[model samples]
Target: MEVELEIKGKKLVLQTGTLAKQTNGSVLVKYGDTYVLCTVVAEKIPKEGLDFVPLTIDYQEKAYSAGKIPGGFFKREGKPTDREILVSRLIDRPIRPLFPEGFNYETQGIASVLSYGDENIADILSIIGISAALTISDIPFNGPVGAVRVGRINEEFILNPDNEESEKSSLNLVVAGTEEAVTMVEGGAAECSEEILVEALKFAHTHIKGIIALQKKLGSIAGKPKREFKVEHGNLKDAIFNIISGKIENALFLQKKLERQQALEALFNECIQNLNTADKDISLEIANAFDKVVKKIMRETIIRKGVRVDGRKPDEIRPITCMIGILPRVHGSALFTRGETQALVATTLGTSEDEQKIDSLEGEIYKTFMLHYNFLPFSVGEVKPLRAPGRREIGHGYLAERALQFVIPSKDEFPYTIRVVSDILESNGSSSMATVCGASLSLMDAGVPIKAHVAGVAMGLIKEDDKVVILTDIIGMEDHYGDMDFKVAGTEKGITAFQMDVKIPGIDYEIFKKALDQARQARLFILKKMYETISQPKELSSYAPRIYKIQVKPEKIRDIIGIGGRVIKGIIEETGVKIDIEDKEGIVRIASSNEASALRAIEIIKGITQEVELGRIYMGKVSRIVDFGAFVEIMPGIEGLLHISQIADKRIQKVSEVLKVGDQIPVKVIEIDDLGRPRLSRKEALKEIEGKNISTK
Candidate 1:
């Protein structure tokens, strides 16, 4: 089966029943020349003892899709790259909330790029294809989700902007939603106003509705009947709630995160012992019920009292503290703490050689600035084996990275590769936002010359029927029980980055606007705290390497680089510095730990590459004696001919009479020959020196 529609002056085609037919559902989506094939499979029987949905979504980009082979010794795809993982998370965030409650089937969705094009990104298409696949499958999903990429250039919003257009756009927002409401939002902007962001979301939703309708049309004809599965924990939940409702409420009102957590755990254990059920697994059911009851109480408390579990009002923010220069060795370091969350962020600066080389389907690209987030188990007071960063960590890191990217100076202005790492020392909620604050502080602390201090705040919403409460800076409990996890990051001017995910169907424009407004208020408060600690970038650390960037003639680049890079290598070894020279641009960046070494390296490079100019006087050394003229070494590796006639005011019997090898004399560049060699005059140089001496006298 096939269906087609028009979106934003482009054709969007969806086809199924022709590929991966054995899967429960499959759909192929094509937009521009990019094609994404999505397939979903679900086990008939639910995994035993599972309380949460085991839904996995993988979005992979095959090198072959872009007509390129794998770039490793194995010559095949290895593991999921960061881009693939981020895309998978993008698809999972919106789709996970759409699954029917208690539908715990072991489900998996795979979206692969079969064809890649520069005109359209495969990530958005993968999302649309997966939504269509789930809609047509037997999986218990309440989804016909729509996704679109919105870019704003010159105050005009462009739907599904291409790569070139995205470069010029100040806003790049990716929104996914159901027919009535938006489900997920992730994007970054150049400090755009809240109204502009709301307008963009409205613009995106208008097109999202059309795509959702198209998915519905495909489902009506080709979708399989949804399977019948129902899970009932209501009776157990009510029984547990009856037993522990009072205790849980009191425990929740405890202000401290750790104290409240311990109190609740003890209460749950007590309730379980009191019930004294025979079925060993009944404990798991009771535990699950206890959690739901807790969620219920928290939500009700917020909706009824308009205050969070921590006793703060819905619009109130947690106490924040910012400190910098805690670490002596690092280039920059800062510690930002809010409520129970803390991030120890550090910055490191390097030369162009430190830039990350990413070989994506589009081609090779270099990233000069990077931010990495690390969440150790100890941050949450858990004991687990250390492992590599998971999807959550990567997603958080990317969001924080984008938030700071707006204020980071361009490479031309500050020619150094920068890296910021945020380590979560303590976590309750909004560790990612803490990372944003710490990263900004550390960048400024490291003397990165950013435009402004950036801060982030996570807003939450609790909606029960008609009552709605917007939270400014939510804690862990509020986020888990709340309907929304909306994080906004930026400078005092406007928003730089934001991410939104809701447990409910979607949020309306009014709610989103209020959330943004509250987030902005919280962000400004945080930024004020940060500025009090460090308002502007400090002087570059003495330990940090100094990088000197210089431009040379394109033709002279080779001369400085010598054959086989021998000359550059010698300079690095002699001065203890790092050098990166761009072949096309003739740009040389020399980095050194010592200022003297950097200056010495620059002098050596200038001596080697600086061109000889006419009428310029230089202190030259006579290199050798020849019959017609004497070769004068004007610059390093550069010699000019000082004819015997120009060597002296009067003609001499022999060249040795006026000058000899190893003799230092003043010489003027009289002319440059056709071959690009300078003709030097010592007599005119002497006369000019004499005139200056007389004037001074």
Candidate 2:
């Protein structure tokens, strides 16, 4: 059966009962020509000891969907790209919380793009597919959440703008929610105002109601009978909470993080010992209930008493420290430490060859500016194995990359490929935002001409019946227990990147706008401290290579690069420099450690391609001494014939008597034949040499 939903004057189609029937549930969602097949599967047996639900979301983009073959050696999709990982994250964030409490059954959801379209992005439709699949399956999902991409162009908001239209818009926001409240939000903006962002969310929710209604209609018929699973239920939760209520309040009152955690853990262990039970399951449930007691006390304290874990005001920012040019040998480096979160970001400048060549369904392209984020378990005071970046790392790195790309200079202005690697030495909360802040400082430290300095702040919300407290610069504990973790990053002027994940059913614009306003204040404060250290880009590191770019005639490119690259290779080998040439604009970029080598390479290129003047003189080489005349090389490859009379002032009977094949001598372009070859005269060169003839053999 197929259900149609009209949202913002656009038609969305959701169909089921046709594909992947073996799975718990499957649906094919189409918006215009774009469509995705989303399927969900739930394991029969529950996994053991999974503190959280074991759920995996995979998003794959097939090249054949767009009528193109994969470009790599495998000629097929092997791993998920950053975009795919991020979209998977986007779809997972909203629905993950809506599952039943303590539901730990293994579950997996996948969205496979089957048809590509030019008008819309596949990610938004993938969200719809996931909701539809889970809604009609036996899995207990509380909602059919609606996802939409909002755009801002000319002070107007657009819902689900096409590819071309989004490029021109200043805001690229993806919002997901049920009919009641928003659950997930992530996007980057062009310094858009906070009011504008709030309005976009409100606009998105109005249409989400229609999508939710359509899903419920399909779910009424296709939803399978709810599956039953057995897990021991415990009644000790209330008893454990009452016994630890007094100790937990004092523990949660401590100002220091580690200090508070120690206090709580000591009380929890003591309570377990007092129970003195041989049943391990009962003991574990009691321990979990003790932790819940802590969450409840902490949230209530902040809501009723207006006291935070750090004992700071809800809108207060943590102390900040910024330093740049810390590494003398690197291109650019900075250390940005805000409270406990620290990011040591290093910047590297490279040629165009360093750009990342991404092969995707759209086509192949290069990314000049890349931000790599690393978060080790030890950064949070834990020891773990080191491996490749996981999904969280990729997602955070992409967020920082999106924030900094806004202020980075264009390729036309700065041609070098820029890379910033942020290593989190310490983390408490909002380390990704810290990476964004540190990367901006590192770019300026490396003498990258950025438009403006950018800063990021993490905001938390504590909401009770009618009261709400918006916390600024939230710490890790607050983020883990708060209602919302709203991260907003941008310049002092406005927001650049925004991300939000909510724990509750939904958030209205009134509270959302208040959080943004609070974050704006925090952002300005952080930027002020950063400016005091280094306001703008300093002088580039002396050790860095000097880059020089120029354009020449398109026809002259062949002359510089001889047959089989013989001439350009010789220039690099002799001058000890690097050169890159482009065929489109005839652009040549030369990078060298010293100016002398760069100038020498330029002279070598000009020697071969320079237009020959009629009366010009050149120091020529005796390439071959023939009987008729010795062939002299006036340039690298342009040789002219020198007759016997041109050898010296005194007429020589034989050319070898005056010039040998390995000899160096002077020559003049006396005339040119009709075949576009130059004829040289040694006698005319001797007159220019003041009649002082020096013989060579």
Candidate 3:
């Protein structure tokens, strides 16, 4: 059946029973020519010990939809690319939060690209489809959430523009929300001010609200009765309230930051000890509620008194300190701390072989730069079970990576594989921004030669009435109390990346612009502090490997490679250097630990390679002397036939009189055959000898 719905001043046509009918809930959604097939399937049982809803969203792309073939070996669909993963995450963020708590069902949401008009993004549509699917499914959700991609083009806001149009815009902001509030946001901007980001969110909300209304209308026609699960509450609630509320009032009054945190922790520990005698099952619930109450109190303090827990002005930033090249053995390292948030970032440079190979629907590709983020429990003054990086870690790492990617030098310009790791030594809020600051410093420390210094700052906003206060370099408490968390990063000339997540329905354009301008001021201050430590990239470390380039004739590429790569392998083994050779078009790169090894590899390459000569003499070895000609070895693995007729000034009857096997002789090149075979003459050598003899006499 085809369902046509009008959403937020746009038309949406969702067609089912036409494509992918096998899935439980599948719909081909069309907003103009861009189309996406959204399907939802639910498992029969819940995942064991899972406290939250296990909703997995997979967004995929096919090359055929884009009218392109997959590149490289194994040219077929593969694992999701980073871009796809990010899109999936965007769809998951807003909808996941809207689901009813304790709904621990295993569910999957897949959005496969059927066609893209090259304009409308599938991200927004996918969010709508997820809501639509759940509306008709047997799952319990307080959704009908709407999503929009907002862009600022020509100093004006645009909602859902084409790809080409978005390229010219300064901002690419994705906002997702319910009718009451925004739940998620992801975007990158062109050095836009905080006010602009906030305004973009407001513009997005207006359109998103319309979409949500359309979803509700559709649900009214096709929605199912939602199942309910009891949220267990016990006597621990009163105990949690008494323990947290008592300390929060005093903790909020403390002016010193560290002292206040200590007091809070002490209170929390005392509460935990009191709960030790109570039921173990309700202990965790009590702790979670206690944390929520603390967050609420913090928010109320900022809203009512206009004072933060740290006792700073509304727009004040925390103390910032930056240090570069902290690790002597590393290629580059930096320690960056803003208030309590600290990150130890390090960079390592390698050859092209070290690049990460990615598999995706687009095709196989190699990424020359990578960023990894790690967060330890100790950073937050907590003791918990240690495990590998989860989805949150991956997502944070990717955000920092994208923010810095705009300024990284291209592979051809800087032929080194770069890997950056950000370790959180302390956490308050905006650790991702801390990673960005640390990465920029570390790159400079490693001598990466970046175009300009990049810095990131997180801005917080508390809105009351028409008045709004924008806080710079927001801490953990401010982030919780604030209505908006706007993060912006860039160099002095322009912006690189920005993300905004709002707790309220949205703010207006004026507020968004104010926030951006305030963020810029904070960002510049942070950049200045960073420059005091390291102004420019240093010379590459001496311990780093050396890379050399060499070019060879295209035809001789196979000869250099030999059978099954034997020739290249032999060179590597002999010189102790890594050689990467391209047979087609002939380009070879040599990377080694020292200059001598690199030069040795080059020597071996030159030995097996052939060079064309117009006229040159060679000291040759006679391999065989026949009646008609003498075969002589000129260069390594190269032989030429010297005719007996041309052996001397006077004709000789037999070749044996002049030359013998295993004899050293001088030969001159007479001509080269069509096949590039050399033709030599002993007669030419004899004439040269006679001339020397006459000169001596």
Number of the top lDDT candidate = 1
Error of 3 at 574 (Å): 2.1
TM-score of each: 0.96, 0.91, 0.79
Q: In candidate 3, which residue ranges exceed 4 Å CA deviation?
A: 4-12, 15-85, 96-124, 134-143, 148-184, 189-217, 224-247, 253-259, 265-293, 304-306, 465-467, 606-610, 618-627, 630-639, 645-668, 682-697
Predicted structure 2, TM vs. truth: 0.91
Candidate 1 vs candidate 3, TM-score winner? 1
Q: Per-residue CA lDDT of candidate 3, range 188-251, in tens?
A: 7666655566667778888888777776766666565765556655566577678666667897
Q: Name the best candidate (by TM-score).
A: 1
Better of 1 and 3 by lDDT: 1
lDDT tens digits by residue: candidate 2, 1-697: 8889866455788899999999999999987778899999999888764446788999988888899988779888888888899989988999888887677899999999999988676998888899999999999888889888999888888888888889899999999999898889999999888988888998888777778888988899788876766555665557777677667777877876678878888887877886647755455666666766677788898998888888888998878999998999999999999988999999998878788998777778799999999998888878999998989999999999888778999887988889999999998898999999999999999999999998999999988878899899999999988999899999987899989998888788889988999899899999998889889997777877777876787777887888999988988999998998987788778888688999888878767776655656678889987778989888767888888877777767887677778787778889887875788877787687765554321
* Per-candidate local distance difference test: 0.91, 0.86, 0.78
Model 2 / residue 265 / CA error / Å: 1.1
lDDT of 1: 0.91
CA shift at 114, candidate 1, in angstroms?
1.0
